[model samples]
Target: MSKFLLSALFGAAVALSSSAFAADQTLAEFHADMGGCESCHADGASASADGAFEFEQCQSCHGSLAEMDDKHKAHDGMMMCQDCHVTHEMNVGQKPTCDACHDDGRQ
Candidate 1:
């Protein structure tokens, strides 16, 4: 193959590889890459009295539970995004499990 073709292939491979590992990055790391805590929080880096501010920020980017698929719509108003997301304790692409709240074994 030509040098140019080899370089392009190498670049694509590297990009794909990086994405493969991005799912393992912490939520903090992923958000920091996009902007920072402020992207998900208000000024002073403190959560609002009822965490409404942070929740709004999340919906601003991720959409409301009602707007999501059936699984998410089911818990629309029953819980806050943080209740399951728990950014500090969750990874970027990790799906929250239902086993925590339901013992019947559901993902």
Candidate 2:
């Protein structure tokens, strides 16, 4: 292969590898960005300690799930709270809209 082709392949490989690594992010990394462990793990409780996430805890900050669900009823089944919000620091505005998957003009 020509040097140019080899370099292009190397660049593409690196990009793909980096994306893969990003997809495997640890919760700790998310905690760091979204605020320290206590931000979500209130009262010194550990999320890993129980392996459970109480949606109620989030509702304390983000509002009731029922209300949010009502607002998002149109995109139901397309995504869930975790699909877009991996952490408490998630900016809802940046989350993918229903159009991302429902953009086939089926609506």
Candidate 3:
């Protein structure tokens, strides 16, 4: 009985380790498959209904770009738009400063 319990424990550990490794491998492959923002963001072919600029289509490559602060401010909740569309050149990969958008309070 003791031997059986030990074997089961070891088997469980091995299974867990294998699962973790598989997950890591998948993440690595995903990272490897990722391309630069310009790969899709640029060109008139990528334009959407929300104007010629958008980033929702970029979640697969760029992930999330929202921010939270001590004031409990969260852009994710307030705006469905991406920062690159309203503030900077999405394909150029240049991030704009806060003042760029907040200057006129239009953002």
List runs of model 1 lying over 4 Å from the truth.
1-18
In candidate 3, stretches whose alpha carbon ends up further than 4 angstroms from where it belongs are: 1-46, 51-54, 66-73, 80-93, 103-107
Steric collisions counted per model: 0, 0, 0
Q: For residue 9, what is the lDDT in candidate 3?
A: 50
**Distance from true position, residue 38, model 2, in Å?**
2.2
lDDT (tens digit, per residue) of candidate 2 on 1-40: 4587457557755765676434344544543444456645
lDDT of 3 by residue, 39-65 (tens): 345552444566324455444334444
Cα displacement (angstroms), candidate 2, residue 77, comes to 10
The C-alpha local distance difference test score for the whole of candidate 2 amounts to 0.50
Each prediction's RMSD to truth: 9.0, 14.9, 14.1
lDDT score, candidate 1, position 76: 94
- Reference-based TM-score of each model: 0.73, 0.36, 0.34
In terms of lDDT, model 3 sits at 0.43
Give me the displacement of residue 91 in model 1, in angstroms.
0.9
Q: Which of 2 and 3 is the better model by TM-score?
A: 2
Off by over 4 Å in 2: 1-35, 42-54, 73-80, 88-93, 99-107
Error of 2 at 40 (Å): 2.1
